[model samples]
Target: MTTDASSSFPFCPERWLSKGIWKEREIPAATTATATKKKKKTETKKTTTTTMTTGRALEAFDEGVAAAAAGDERARRRARRALVRACEEEERRIGREEERIERRRDREEAEEEAAAAAADVAVVRAREIAVANREAAVERRKEVVTEREDAVAVEMAALHQEQMAAGGEEQSRGEEE
Candidate 1:
């Protein structure tokens, strides 16, 4: 919603500025509005609208004092309603801003939590992978050790068999001699 910087004639000089957003503003000395001006020219009704400066629109009490120029009951009611509307509008705006901030905060918090969870999962996976690699290395070492022991046992057995055959042949030859 928007409002004119200056009120129309008869209410203009009151200089009440009604705005919704809260902020610092500079009230100008006077505000202008276009009003209908009539001129009778030889039985012809000539009408023209001209812009004129009426009153200084004050930055403060814009809603309550807008109708200040009229010291009447209707003007007072209008002013009251204007002030109330302004207040309600401001409240709505503040509420919307707060909701927006809350949503942003919630989104950020969720994202941070998700990131932390992902990091934790990654760390767990890395550890599991490391453990798996270590286990695999251990199995390879066991296989290598078992193969070496088997090979050594076979070599010793063959050497013992050779010695027995040589001893038996020597005894026979000696007996023959």
Candidate 2:
């Protein structure tokens, strides 16, 4: 029995239902973030970050199966085990990165809140200072008015004494006439 490469090729995730790394499991929908990673020995050989395609992954899985069918069960189990371990590690790393992102967002919100509170405090302090300045100005105006009234009262007292003296002299002069 010969297997056609095109028929069993893992071109996309949907076609990996029968013979891909994920055996007997339902394929996740397109919205789910699911991807498989393969270890690359040569970094300079590839232009893209993804060194292996689905086709190459499927080929590795098939080779493992063939080795097992040829009486090498250890090789097949090790291959599957390594794949599963790699997937788990990738999941852990992704989780840590997501947690870091969430913490950063929370920190940014806290900083914004602190800045707003500081601004509010500054506004209140400015209003208090303005009110104090206005009260001081009013006190200064009252002092000026009180000083002017005292000066006017002194001038009136001096004019009254002059009038009294003049009136006495005129009365004496009229009695003599």
Candidate 3:
């Protein structure tokens, strides 16, 4: 299929030139018995036969032109078929590229969606952690306030006991006097 065009010539120009075309020799009319008898009686007469080249040359030239046209037509058909096959191959290549591109886009979109989902999950986890930390801080502040109230209550109780003891001692001393 990939052979050179010159290898497929109808007739090689160099070979045709070496072995030139020749016209067929014309045959004389068939002699009857009477014409043969007359020829035997008379002397040998030379018959003139026409060997014209113009008509035969024109015919050969016409034939050569027709053969060349046919060969040209064949060459054109081959070229057209080759072009069509190349176009079909190009179309198939483009189709494959488009399919590959589409698949890549689909994969990229899926990856992007997965990444977005992961980010959303991360944001939710961070918010949950922030809320838990705020709750823990509030609990710690409550515990500190409770401890301060307990300490204040213990101090007031100790002061009340001292005042009651002092009042009892004064009353005893006054009674003895």
Candidate 4:
């Protein structure tokens, strides 16, 4: 005869039992209790799964052992060596990646510095060109002023020569009268 704990409780047993209230009842058969415990254990175990890749090394070692058991000595050695080599290679790859990144950063900085220097040189050259152009313009203006003064002097000299010729003609007429 099975005695239900739910029936033994004085309070509303169904409600209290659902709430995990303990009550006294006849003990279950040893076989049934053991079976229930085993089932619960199995269920809990089934829920767990390994998620870390660090276990891969152990897995590779286990594979190597299995390969040796299968009478493949070369396969076993290869797998074991591969596991070790993979770890070493991963470390080296990380180092090389870091070095490459550093080199790229250095190169970019150098290029930027060169560009800034070139821009500075360009600005200096532009200023020099502007100064030279201004000086040449001033010199051309001076030359123009000199040429205008020379032309005016030549016109005054010509007028003085014409007046002297007219005075000589007037002196000849007075002598004839």
Most TM-score-accurate candidate? 1
The candidates, ranked best first by TM-score, are: 1, 2, 3, 4
Q: Model 2, which residues run further than 4 Å from truth?
A: 1-73
lDDT of model 4 at position 51: 22
The residue-level lDDT of candidate 1 at 110 comes to 100
Q: In candidate 1, what are the lDDT values of residues 1-177, reduced to their tens digit?
A: 133323332333232333323444333434455344556333433344321111111222354344444455576566555544554554565688799999999999999999999999999999999999999999999999999999999998988888888999999999999
TM-score of 3: 0.49
TM-score of 4: 0.43
Model 3 off-target regions past 4 Å?
A: 1-81, 170-177
Q: What tens digits encode model 2's per-residue C-alpha lDDT throughout 1-177?
A: 124422332232333344444433232333433334547342323223332333344455576556656767787666555444544544465588799999999999999999999999999999999999999999999999999999988889888888888999999999999
Better of 1 and 4 by lDDT: 4
Candidate 4 C-alpha lDDT tens digits along 82-164: 55654455446558879999999999999999999999999999999999999999999999988988888888788777888
Query: What is the Cα-based lDDT of residue 99 in candidate 3?
Result: 100
Better of 1 and 2 by TM-score: 1
Ten-residue region with minimum lDDT total, candidate 2: 42-51
Clashing pairs in 1: 15-57, 17-62
Best by lDDT: 2
lDDT of 2 at 162: 88
Error of 3 at 119 (Å): 2.4
